[model samples]
Target: MASFKKTATGWRADVFKKGIRRSKTFRAKREAVAWSNQIEYEIEQGHHDTGAAPPNATMYHILERYRDDVSPKKRGARWEVTRLNQMMRDPLLADVKLSDVGPRHFSAWRDKRLKEVSGSTVNREFNLLTHACKLAWREWQWLKEHPMAGVSRPPENKPRDRVITDAEIESYVETSGFSFKTPPATVLSRVGAMFLFASETAMRGGEICKMKKTDIDFNKRVVYIPETKTGVPRWVPLSTKAIKILNHVLDYTKGTPTVFCVTASQRDALSRKIMKKAGLEGINFHDTRRTALTRLSQKFGPMELAKISGHQDLKILQSVYYAPDPSDLVEKLE
Candidate 1:
């Protein structure tokens, strides 16, 4: 049976048919009656379930269980754990019980969160929540069904392509030859050439920085990136321009195990220093790879760009593809 009554501060609606039921406070008698009516509707719709009280479960307890027991067994689990902890720090979902969590509660949380997040961010949090519920569904076996079983996450927003322009490239090559943009030594000037190498070779900074003479096959013009982002063994071909830039870097780093293996922020500082030094604007080292990918896609095809960029997805290259120049196309045709 459901009931509504006037209270000191407001009206109260209470339902008595479930094992774990909730009562809500309303400001007016009409509001309380409406809430009581909705409660009945929910119960009639079979949304309200009856079960024994859930064992004492807290937000932290679920996180610890998911992180250590479930997450560790999955690939890219560390990132999941990090995201979970960050989401937990949000006050909205912190106090809600895992057992009491329903599609309605999740929807309310999502609606509240839409004000503060991008579509992609909202989708990401929903995905994280879905993943946690999936783990619970597979392992816990205690829950009847995943709370987010039918929840609809927002569509991912289109992300900007990370392409760099030729003017930017020219500025970058000129700057890399100069003094270090940051502190300590003038050695950081290699940042400019580093950007050039990345642009020409599509080599990741970390991989190229760790490259040694033993790893290089100058005769073959192939740099073996023994480890890659996909955890698959792969090779990246060296272009003549890339060879020239790397040769310069090798001359500068004649005796070192790691070549320009500074922290990413330090690399950013070096780039800014070079950008300021060269009197050029809006160029960064990371942009070089994007530039290279974009240029390659225009000249060759998506497959070729994917081959060079180590991207398994051709759609990625297509997304960043800039139109080729007609004059340049005529020259290539000739």
Candidate 2:
């Protein structure tokens, strides 16, 4: 038999068979009735899988699950893993119940962290926590509710990300070509090739470093990014400039399987040196990713830009990569 009943908390439906019971909660009477009907039909179909969905799972466990099971499958696995490790170390989350965390905890954490970190950084933590709770609520049934439901992220904090502008790029080419650091005239070319290659490719620093002999296909004009943010492999086409750099690198490592090996810090130092030499102002290594998306979005829709960058959604791309909202109407009024 199927039955619907009202309780103080809300409404629920129960299905009974031989002293056994199955029930689900609802916020409305109509919903209760509909769910009751659905349960009865499911029973008739010989599928009864409802049980006491556990809600006492610790926050740490859910985060670990996401890191191990969910993150490694992403192209951003390296960065995601680092973020998860940092979250796991947070004192609030260390020995607490996932179910017990509420909006207060989330709000307090975000507010406090904002003082110490950039808003974009705070947003990353907030997003990470939200996803952890979502996995617990939806996939694991480990939480009665996701506490991050109403938690808002901090606004972006954009200090000039050090980027070598078009002017600087030309200066780098000029100085390296004629100056003392010029190419071996026997070995590969000198300076800016790696940086320019990276800028034009939009390939992440790590991706560029980890590239292999077999990854590039000159005729196809595509490089198979076998590992990506989604853990799903994807392909990114290379610009002619990017190809020229890769070919240059290949000449030096003719027998080696690894592409160019460069650390994030090393690249940063080189970029800073080049920026100083060219007398350019502001631009960061990661800004290349931004520059790529912004230019691409001009030609392709946000969706197409997202495809190249492996962003899960356009909103994220727009928030970070899109130019600031224009105010032409306000200007006209002024």
* Candidate 1 residue lDDT tens string, 31-93: 877867776776677776553222444444455456655778765575677776666566666
Q: Which ten residues in a row have the lowest lDDT in candidate 1?
A: 178-187
Model 2 per-residue lDDT tens digits across residues 162-275 = 434577666755543422233323211233555566667666766766678798889998888887756667778788777877776666666765665555556556666766
Q: Give RMSD to native, each candidate.
A: 13.0, 14.5
Cα TM-score per model: 0.63, 0.58
Candidate 2: residue 112 Cα off by (Å): 1.0
lDDT of each: 0.65, 0.66
Task: Give candidate 1's TM-score.
Answer: 0.63
Q: Stretches of candidate 2 above 4 Å error?
A: 1-58, 157-163, 170-192, 219-241, 263-281, 289-334
Clashing pairs in 1: 176-192
